[model samples]
Target: MPTLEPSAPPSTQAAEKASRALTIERLQEQAALARSIADRLPWQLAHFDLDLRCRFGNQAFCDGLRIDPSALEGRPFQDCFPQDALPALLPRFMQALGGEKQLRLTEQSTPGGAHTFTETSFTPDVHDGVVRGVFVETKEVAGRARVDDLAQNKRRFDLMADALQDSCIYFLDPVGRITEWSESAHRLHGFSREQVGNMHLADMAAPRVGEEAEIGIDDTIRLAIDRGQWETRGWLKRAGAEAFWGQTLITALRGDNGELEGLSCITRDMTAMKDLDRVMNDLNAELDRRVTQRVRQHTVPNKDLDIFTHSITHDLRGPVRHINTFAGLIAEELGENASEEIRHFRDAMKRASQRLNAMIENLLTYSRIGRIDLHPERLAMTNVLEGVVSRLRQAAPDRQIQWEIQPDLPMVVADAAMVNDLFTRLLDNAMKFTRKVEPAEIQIGCRTESDGTCLFFIVDNGAGFDVAKASNLFLMFQRQHHSLDFEGYGAGLALCQRIVQRHNGRIWLDSTPGHGCAVYFTLPVETAMAASGLAALGC
Candidate 1:
């Protein structure tokens, strides 16, 4: 073996030293880089030595505790934290040091009367298989928790907004730019989310100008922000260039600093309500006008009827008494010597007087039916028809007629006496028209439609009129058939039309020359009963 030289030994020693130094430098660089990374971490980071002394603390930890990082180094963690919070924090720290794995803790603090929530984790730091210290990463959870809470609140608010049926809610900034809009707002204004956002509130106003109209919407917003709230009701423009009445309320929103941030707006569509009010007003006006006209038209006629009643009473009594007295005188004067012609004349005079009395009674009844106040009731139609047939049998004993009344006919809401009068007139017409047919037939029935409405019809195999003259059929004192064929004052059909109209129903005629006639009338469905409750009573 060759003897080692001193120079060679020195060179080899230098090389070994360089290699050891480089390894140590690499380890130091890695440690420094880790420290730098820990210091700049977004979450609060801190390191403690085995002696329970803080060896290092990042800028985030320093900021969170409101302490200087340089001053915090080498300080005991117990000394740095408040005395009350240390006990709770100690257990987690010790757990990480005991090799029980990392631990997490949630803590709370009320500083300056404001609560702060925190989530902290303790991770053990080991070196060369020896537990040296613990690393703590703390995150401020107060802000994140508040944000989550706000998100949940917004979800609930959105659901409530969608559920609303009557009112629309929206939000705008103090500068009048729309920020948020609800589903109802979209439906009422006919604006989508893309169309509404960033739009000025004034853009929703109607085109017309008036004293009640909004002039400067931006100025109104400023006023509202200053005063806290404002409200108004007026016309608003819709997407289709239509206008609708709306009631709007605006309120200012303030920030934590009590500075005005935005405005909250709520609008309610009142178009239907306004329309109903206008229609009611028009209807009342029309009713008043019609009543005035009717009073004027009937004043002279009523006076004439009164005068005729008085004069006819006196004139009829005088003639009837004279005829009776003369007939008695003729019968007594020609006893056993009386001619057959004399007896026949006496019988004829008595019969004519009786017929005259019957005619006068009928006239009085007809006038009463027209003038009497209508007292409507819900009556069984079957009973009414039976009553009418009984009355007709007594009136015209000589006529033979067949009645076909439908069983369980739908009940009609009308005046009992007026309905009786109507039936009497219809049946009397039928009897007269079908006098030559020998077997006169009359049919009455009802049918229910798909819409839940009921229709009533009266059919008669009688002398029907031409379709061209149907318009004149319901006029007062206008008779299509001759008086010699059907004796009537022609007031019945007109009265029927009036009664049907009063009940919010309609009546019409369907007939042709030499064919049977059918009179049809319609009543509203049950669903509409609530809207027109008085319709059942023919009001």
Candidate 2:
């Protein structure tokens, strides 16, 4: 009856007290969990009270500070640091304790003679919304920073080696086992990293090394170690079982103390260079041989021509002088009775001699053209054509011809006389073939192409040719048309093609059975100019 009167229920009081206890327990659990996490973290963690006194620390913090937890507890943080250093760090600690959640800072320490840089974070520790202490986590960055610097230096060196183009760079151990190989080394030696490592230099030299040459490798290594470098050129064996001449420069790698540690071998493939040198030597020898052969072949022929020229001048002159003297005596002795038949016979003999002399002159000119070296020069096509046309008009006064010349024709490089002869021969053929036409029409022009090539063309409304027989056009003395129809020895187009080839150009024909023929030829401008200069001076 007394409890039921008006007193507060016991259950309500109990529930209020239980709620308060639960809140306290939760807070304790949270604090315990926070402390446990702070202790287990890899970074050094320490807690200082509001007064900047050390209250708690993890094992990592004790190890980092080089102090025991029992020795550090309740001690002022300033007391633990060096006397001069404490003042500089005190402000940051105070700020952290004054409810600032994070305070990041850097400090220097000289545990050894070397100074170390430490990065640390100071965090405020709070309980029930009250600033309790500062939790400090520290890490040593000096060792990691040094490792990063070394890694960066290695990357730079690797990049430099990869960028090189010429020489192969690689490292070998003291026993001549491959250690490092670059891309250039792989390209030069034909051995990749997987195939090069653990392989001895002797194995790589197997193809080039005779049984007696094996000692040279050891000698080379010893010499490099003693002299700091060794260089040699010899044949080298490749991974693909191919062998090439190589020039190898091996440099000894040394430690800081200058003791030999490894070898840096740079091998260059000298096969192409050596082969080029051999080719040059062979070419020189061949040139000498050809000179000797030419002397042997032409000596007798040149002497024979000289003898023939002398005989024709001296021996033939004696007979002609005797005949003339006898004829003069007959005319003087029997002046009135000198027979007309005798005079006519003497005239015939003179004409025959003149014809023989003309034939000999033509033969000599043709022979000289063959033996003379080609001297090319830059020549205006219009000038050469005009000269040829002037000469042709004088030679044939009765022929009526229509000559069409292209304006501003491209310049050509060639021997002027040869080009003049070429045009003359073509003009003669045109005149001969177009005899059936009332008026002969000849056209000369040039076309410039996009590829910087110039095509010179000579077209004639004359006797056309069969397409199947065009191949015979450029052959010496191989005339598709009869001599009566073309009045040629068939040497003009042959000479033209040869000249074009010498200038690194080409010649071709465009013709049909009934269509007029067009002869097209090309000349490289730069090469033509150089050759023309030589040709003009007859050098």
Candidate 3:
């Protein structure tokens, strides 16, 4: 290169120029970074010179205290906070400027008219090996950090229990009294929260005597407290309903010092299993009786009864169905060639076959109700009634019937499927009896008693029967109205009566010979018990 003229010995001056250029570039980057951080960071930031004057304050630093950043810029530090605050804060700032690399400080002050707390950090800004200023970062920690740890833990526990089905989770005080109740608890125990006051575990547990542990409520609590846990399965009754087997777990919730704080009671309803067990035992007993009778050359009474029922239902069905089939075929074949008397005889045969088949079906259904298990539940009567009305309307779409069903009916505890059947039968009967009346009127509703029992009624403005015949209303194969007028198998009311009795409920009728008839039934409430109103049924 013009020979690089004699490359001057790495010029010291050039090195100084390079260093200054690099420093200026680094400063520009630092300023850009500071601007980027001010907008991006959650914390508030500010800077003050050695003269203890605020030179720069980010928007957040001013906004938190409701102070304008523009007004506070270049103002003394005292202007940013209370005068009293400055005295305690000055020492931290002085320490940072006097060569401390970093300082942490906490102070309480009234910010925006509320008592608030702030944690601030001061970092000494050094230049040329000397502290030039302090860079401050401020953050407000809201109001003494008031936290409810107890409530938080309780919420966590409830969240864990919310996922369970067929299980009731509740809490009991150390003394065995109910404290907290969950929705599952209400559904399982048939008790609302308001009705659970001061109720102990013993109140719901069916008394057990001469069994393992020979344990009562006191024993249950003692075991849980002493052993820190207890689990058992037994019959439990609630709200005046029959006893149902349940598997219960009692855990003593202990404190840090191993002292009992309270107890957690988690009960899973095993009523279905218990019912199944009954069914199994019944089947076993029947099988054993049959086997024993076969060995001893004797016939079991139940077996003979079953054979008779089978003969009536199944064997007789063959001939009746054939008779109906042949009658229908004969009617089709005879056409116009048949005499009027012949046609009339064929029609009667068809009618009789249908009537017999209906009676058989009704008898089977009635028997099934006795054999099947009863599973009681809390029911929305409105929904049940609505479903019944829907089905009845489907069956008889042409009927001119007006239904005056009341709203907001009280919920009842009974087998839901049985309730549906009972409503369908009763409502259909009401519509059938009112066929002759112009604009048939049927009213279905419930009246709550002062004692909390519910009296449900189905009233119909129709061809009412004599109250004397009401006694036969729930008897098998008994009918008040002539079959020629109102076609029925005379099994609906009887089936309904059986269902009511199985539910520990009662059914009765109110009627005169002329105007209308009202059918009333009583069901126990789920949440609380009333005096058993057997007297009201006037049975």
Candidate 4:
């Protein structure tokens, strides 16, 4: 067996270096071919470095500027134009060096003693997230038609930006300096157009806490360049006022040649929503803290936990009752004069209060199930199931149902009252879920286990659910199906679970989506194994 060495041999190292050199040589060849193509183009093109000195010039550039090709390279931009033109041209070039693209339409005097309209554009040369130089493209335009079209489109966009009230839209140069500010932006940011000119967008950002504060405008610009757009939420400072929560969307605008031209920034004030979210988070934290403290102090019997639940629920009922009473009073006062919209609102209020009251009642019921003493006896499962089904049929008399009951079900030692409540909730669930079925079918059966225990199941041909979500089914306030399809408080299974636990039994379910489901539970048939009286709960 040969072992691999840690370091490469000298021959392998030489081969890698040769491969890299070949790749670089190929790239240089491609660059030269591109330059040759640019030299032949009719449009004048030149490159200038950060020092404002020309680095390269094509044939057209030398002919248009009337400068020798040899002298053009390494010459200052100021010497290329006439003395009078420098005043107007210098500022535009400066903006380009600062990462802003510049476009100018000027009338220039030709050597033939004639004036011609010229269109010039200065595009920044950015490399590796740094501004290296600028590329200048120039051509003579015969008429002013192109200039008129550009001016008209600019006006239309300005009008559109001004019309927005709740949102502010602004434009930035390629390097994130403010280039265009609208009237709406002025009102929202408290900055006039003159004040915002050449200002970096990051100046308006409010001081933020935590790690997010470390991310600056340059980071956002780079992200937008990579992803085309970026969205974030943070505080934006307003002049002479408190900072507001702003939801900002930054989009990178690119030219036809895939070069970054500018950025479009839109920010919407979201202070109210931010405040509401903070309030909710604080309330949740406080509630959790109080619940934790109470649990720690009352680690006694189940009776104490039930009393605590009852006391809190009792306090909550006062406000809900007030809302219900006031809503009814308002409706009665309006009487026949009330409009349909007002009446609808009044009814919605009533429904909300009623639903809240029902939830509280269910909570109380769940809390009491474990506290109350259990009376153990040999209870007949068949009779318990029959009574529950009879009440459901009476409640919904119009519905047709098919019942399948296995006769002579094995008896189980459990609390008759608790077992009856358990069957009522489970049977009621089967009926509610099967509301859409043509003929609802329910099956009830029980079998005696080898360990002297009875296993019972209730199968319903109803709207089923994925068996994977069974863990949440026994939790309070968890519903597998939508309430609009079938009405439920989401507490039936939780109550059933509580009852089964009190009797020292186990409960589980199995189902296939869109078909049906079966709930199974085990109860001890032997009296010795049955749990009786008040039992200490871990909860």
Q: Which candidate is the best by TM-score?
A: 1
Stretches off by above 4 angstroms in model 4 are: 1-303, 527-539
* Model 2 misplaced regions, further than 4 Å: 1-350, 367-375, 394-398, 406-408, 425-429, 432-436, 445-529, 532-539
Provide the TM-score for each candidate, comma-separated. Answer: 0.43, 0.41, 0.42, 0.43
- Candidate closest to the true structure, highest lDDT: 4
Worst 10 residues of 1 by lDDT: 530-539
TM-score-better candidate, 1 vs 3: 1
Cα lDDT computed for each candidate against the true fold: 0.73, 0.70, 0.77, 0.82
Total residue pair clashes for candidate 3: 0
Q: Is candidate 2 or candidate 3 better by lDDT?
A: 3
Report the candidate with higher lDDT, 3 versus 4.
Answer: 4
Per-residue lDDT for 361 in model 2? 50
Candidate 2 to truth, TM:
0.41
- What lDDT tens digits, residue by residue, belong to model 1 across residues 1-539? 99976566778999999999999999999988987887778888888988899888888888877988779888898886666556446655776787544333343536665444456778889889888999877876647678456556666887888777767898875567776667888888888876764577888877456525553676678778888988767778778758888878889988677856468998888889979998999999999999879986886787677567656755676777787788788788889787888789878888777656655555554444444555666767789888888888888898778889999877665666666766676666776667766578888888887765678888888778887966787775667888667766666677677656655667888887667688887654444344336433422
Which regions of candidate 1 are displaced past 4 Å? 1-355, 386-403, 435-440, 448-455, 462-539
Which is superior by TM-score, 1 or 2?
1
Clashing pairs in 2: 375-535, 376-531, 376-532, 377-532
lDDT of 4 by residue, 303-393 (tens): 6768899888888999999999999999999999999999999999999999899999889889888667667777777787778888888
Give the local distance difference test score of model 2: 0.70
Ranking by TM-score: 1, 4, 3, 2
In the range 1-539, model 3's lDDT, one tens digit per residue, is: 36556655578779988999999999999977886778576778888998889887777877765877668768888777666455445655766787664333343435564444456777899999988999988776543443233334545766777767878898776668776677778877788877875578888767556432246677888999999999877777667577667889999998677656568899988889878988999999999989777855543554456456756787778888999999989989999999999999998898889989988888777767765666666788999898889888999989978889999988777777888888888888898889999979999999887776788999999999998756777898898988889888788899999888766678999887668889998777775442243222211
Q: Which candidate, 1 or 3, has the higher lDDT?
A: 3
